[model samples]
Target: MMEMFDFRTNNSNGSVKRRLLWVEMESVFGDLPPSGISGSSHNSFTVEKSAITPQECENAVSLTHVGRAGEAQMVDVSPKESTKRIAIASCNVILGKKVFDLVLANQMAKGDVLSVAKIAGISGAKHTSTLIPLCHNITLSHVRVDLHLNPKNYSVDIEGEAASTGKTGVEMEAMTAVTIAGLTVYDMCKAASKDIQITNVRLESKTGGKSGQWSREE
Candidate 1:
């Protein structure tokens, strides 16, 4: 049985807003629960409501990336103070048995697979702003790409980390590194298996900037 959950924010009355965190349930016990199961027994799934201050509500209404009249524009960070910003992202490439063995044995037709991918990831991180419009061009201080082979899952996990001292966060740079690294793996291994799949690209963690630190819970 599988389930899906959707979370969204609902703002009403301009003073307070509620964040709806909904979880869809699949019944394991036939169409319905047997015997004494009643509506009152499922109180644990209730969604809670919270109060939002006026300032916070106003801030939420203003979209930073969109200017007046729904015009898209780059965010102005000139007034923001420069601070140490770091971000990490990850993705996985699922490979077939032949490709997996080839990667594990470092016998891919394209020379060293991981080494070239690492260098490409670093280069991609350094040039993220040029690749994606509206992104601030930041001077990165450090960039690292790590690739780990998961024999149990027949996949390779790529992780990218980027750091910079700038007004904007390096989340885009880290994400770009992970994306290019995954693509490089596919490009190198395509001759062995065209069925290779790259997936689960996402930001794992970020630190510094006005938001401080944030990490995805496992």
Candidate 2:
């Protein structure tokens, strides 16, 4: 708490008047604020807010990816148990109607667009660690990529599922798989429509890990 100082001065009638002033405890006492009632309030008071308590400071939290020195650091999962982990991610490749029709008929110049994209998704899942510097390399036990042609939106919906038994989760791998798959579809249809877009890339569901199960619906 701040210290209250009383400065004395003489009035015109020779009466003594005092004014209370708010200042830092260290400035006047040259020490930390004492743990006791120092004085009473004045007619006009200048309140000084105290610093946070030790308990409050101890309860503060920081980001998991940040180190004690506030630098970026990879999470250490060495102490975690190896469990069956599965993650699913999805994205949409919005190809214009003209390009969508070509892809639906398997007539893209880049060969079968859906087939090539599926392959790319699985490959991307395997190399997720290389693509993302902070991601851990997981020995994925299974990887599946599925592509569906959405007639209403003229978009190819891609979903990738990754499964592994490792310390860290496979969500990043699943996301990378869908992202690469969507990009592959965009590449195949770019000749027909340069405006093709990859959108809504996100994790759909996950199982295992210390948190158990989670889904987009949750």
Candidate 3:
């Protein structure tokens, strides 16, 4: 699975055509966003906004639903080749002053909230397949979590990085780790503050594979 290849083809005119092919096999289900949109007073509701509205999302959710029992419809990954992959995801939670103070002081009832959540985030990265259905289980090279506090609003930024050398990137794993870690933080510190707001979970950067590289625009 770790083999990397380089190839060159010859044309009828005696000219060489060089290209690189990278194998990638990722489940459409794993690509779907787990959260659904809900109408808000500030935003208008529209059928176009539903998960099934867009063709890609519809394909993502419905393609696996074959009518017959034990039916199988595998996605085509034959054209794809293997390459190293990595992904990073991040999110933040805004905490109230009282709770933030308690957390900084390590006075929360739950005890060492940040440390526990950091560990949880790393573990979550390793177990992303279990938490998210349809995602393939691949060995991860590294998982890192960072927590930072915004002194002004008592907010905490949770960042997770997941790395692997495989057919697919680890974006979902990093995202899941950040999300679960944020939830764990809230759970641990809720006694001091129940008004925490989790916000802006997103992919930060990714490298390797056929797609090349991507990084969040500043």
Candidate 4:
């Protein structure tokens, strides 16, 4: 059977606005009755006008990565102006007590852990597009990776910064750098202790995008 329901709400000036909605319910194996509305009727369905502001509408339309059907696609940045872009990412590598002591004393069998990790990080940033499917192949102007030891936690903190002049931001590159650097640390210290852990890989800050600069809160 078909049912009509009335939905009522107050308008801005306190006047009541009523909308009629049609719903159909089914019974067990019975011949369906026709809806009074014609098969080709255009007024059978009602579409309410959006209440979004002009600025909100503009922002919604500016998201170009996907289509109206919500498919995944790369955003076209060809029309975007090229600008200097910088991003910083950070991660931590926790080591066992024996491995931590060895790292501080530079006695690891795998040689200097921090230096090798730094080089690996820069290489990772340079090849970010090759690693991540959707990332753009940006020519980075500068890449830096630093590692610091925290004796109390037996952890090494890794940070990576990437800079480029391009249509897209370098945030992906920075994140890739930090991730690879952490992996490198794990590889170099695994012989000393198999319990090494890599954690908290994240983008700490990014600058030079349409959205402007962003940083994580403490």
Candidate 5:
């Protein structure tokens, strides 16, 4: 299906009047050329709409991280635009009643449990690229880890948020932060309880880049 999108061509000659045009995704591969694309002054065309679903778009480019010879490869983002990106992830540590009370009272033997976990989570976020081979090492503007005691479930809910201005999103960093923080909680409280469980380590929301914003519904 064709879609209407804002488009403009900017060149050394000057900028064309911004206008809305109907174009198809196939136009990207030169299958059909829309009007006003043939002149020498037409250096570039930026289209802001597409006719395919996100999953289809991703599936179309699924092989981008693999070479023709089938070896694993890193995606090149040098040509992509840099934008502010942020992501939040969360995990729950089910520590039972005894351990939850102990943590709530800050009585863990390994010093302040939440404080240490926060620091570990921040550190983990900064080193996410190292932990995951395909992740890009982007400069982070901020990283925060928060843990709350949930009396209803007798669990500790840990959330990690990361922000950066770069070509890639911080989703992986946020998820890694929560995972490391959850593991640290287990390490600090294992002597008190053996059945600690880390559950629902997942990305909650992500914003910026070409795909825009996404959030998980409650």
Candidate 6:
């Protein structure tokens, strides 16, 4: 299921105005499709349409455009304070034997495929702002990646972990790490198989922040 925030407040005449903010998942499943493991369908959490304050709406609006003007506007971490943050991301790639063989042998032309890609994934997690159009630049303390080969399905699975101490969670970092790693896998294996596909990238869990802990039941 997913958890989201909706900000709302009363207008000058006391009528309510609502804004759909942050559509994020509470938890995600890494298993392949046909098991209802996909990330698209999930539950959501919402606040009442008249519960928000004017200041909160303004803050949210301003936060959305922090880095756009090429200004180094320091994000106010005071209101959010500190909290332990973590996110898990996973993705799968289906390919032929040659692609798997190259991965297994570490003979891809792009150099040490897994090792280099792992580094890239970690770096990407730290620098998600550069890749994603509008993401906060966060200080991530930990990133770990695990790769698995599933011969039965002729696919590769990537799992990533991201942790930090901040207001916003590291879900974006985890998701970015997994995505970059999956893309790297595709790049290295494309020479061997043109039918390669990356699928099911999503956040598996998160801890800390105001929302508390969340994990997929399935």
How much lDDT does each candidate structure score? 0.82, 0.83, 0.74, 0.82, 0.85, 0.73
lDDT of 4 by residue, 39-142 (tens): 74433334454466558866774556665545567777899999889999999999978899999999999999999999999999999999987788888999
Estimate, for each residue in 1-218, the C-alpha lDDT of model 2 and write its tens digit: 65332333335432221221223334455454333436734333345544766588679774778766456799999999999999999999889789989988888988999999999999999999999988888799999999999999999999999999988899999999999999888888888889998999999999998989999998
Supply the TM-score for candidate 5: 0.71
* Model 5 misplaced regions, further than 4 Å: 1-63
- Could you give candidate 3's per-residue lDDT for residues 6-112 as a string of tens digits? 22224433232112111111132223222233543232111221233346754663544243333464334446676788888999988888888888998988899
Model 4 TM-score (2 dp): 0.70
Regions of model 1 farther than 4 Å from truth: 1-61
Model 6 quality (TM-score): 0.64
lDDT of 1: 0.82
TM-score, per-candidate, Cα-based: 0.72, 0.73, 0.65, 0.70, 0.71, 0.64
What clash count does candidate 6 reach? 0
Clashing pairs for model 3 are 22-81, 23-80, 23-81, 23-82
Model 1, 2-31: lDDT tens per residue?
A: 222222223353222122222112222224
Q: Rank the candidates by lDDT, best first.
A: 5, 2, 1, 4, 3, 6
Clashes of each: 0, 0, 4, 0, 0, 0
* Pairs with backbone N, CA or C atoms under 3 Å apart (clashes), candidate 1: none
lDDT by residue for model 6 (123-206), tens: 778888788765677788999987788887778888999999887778989989989988888887787778999999988888
Better candidate by TM-score, 1 or 6: 1
Ranking by TM-score: 2, 1, 5, 4, 3, 6
Higher-ranked by TM-score: 5 or 6: 5
> How well does model 3 score by local distance difference test?
0.74
> Which 10 successive residues of model 3 have the least lDDT summed?
17-26
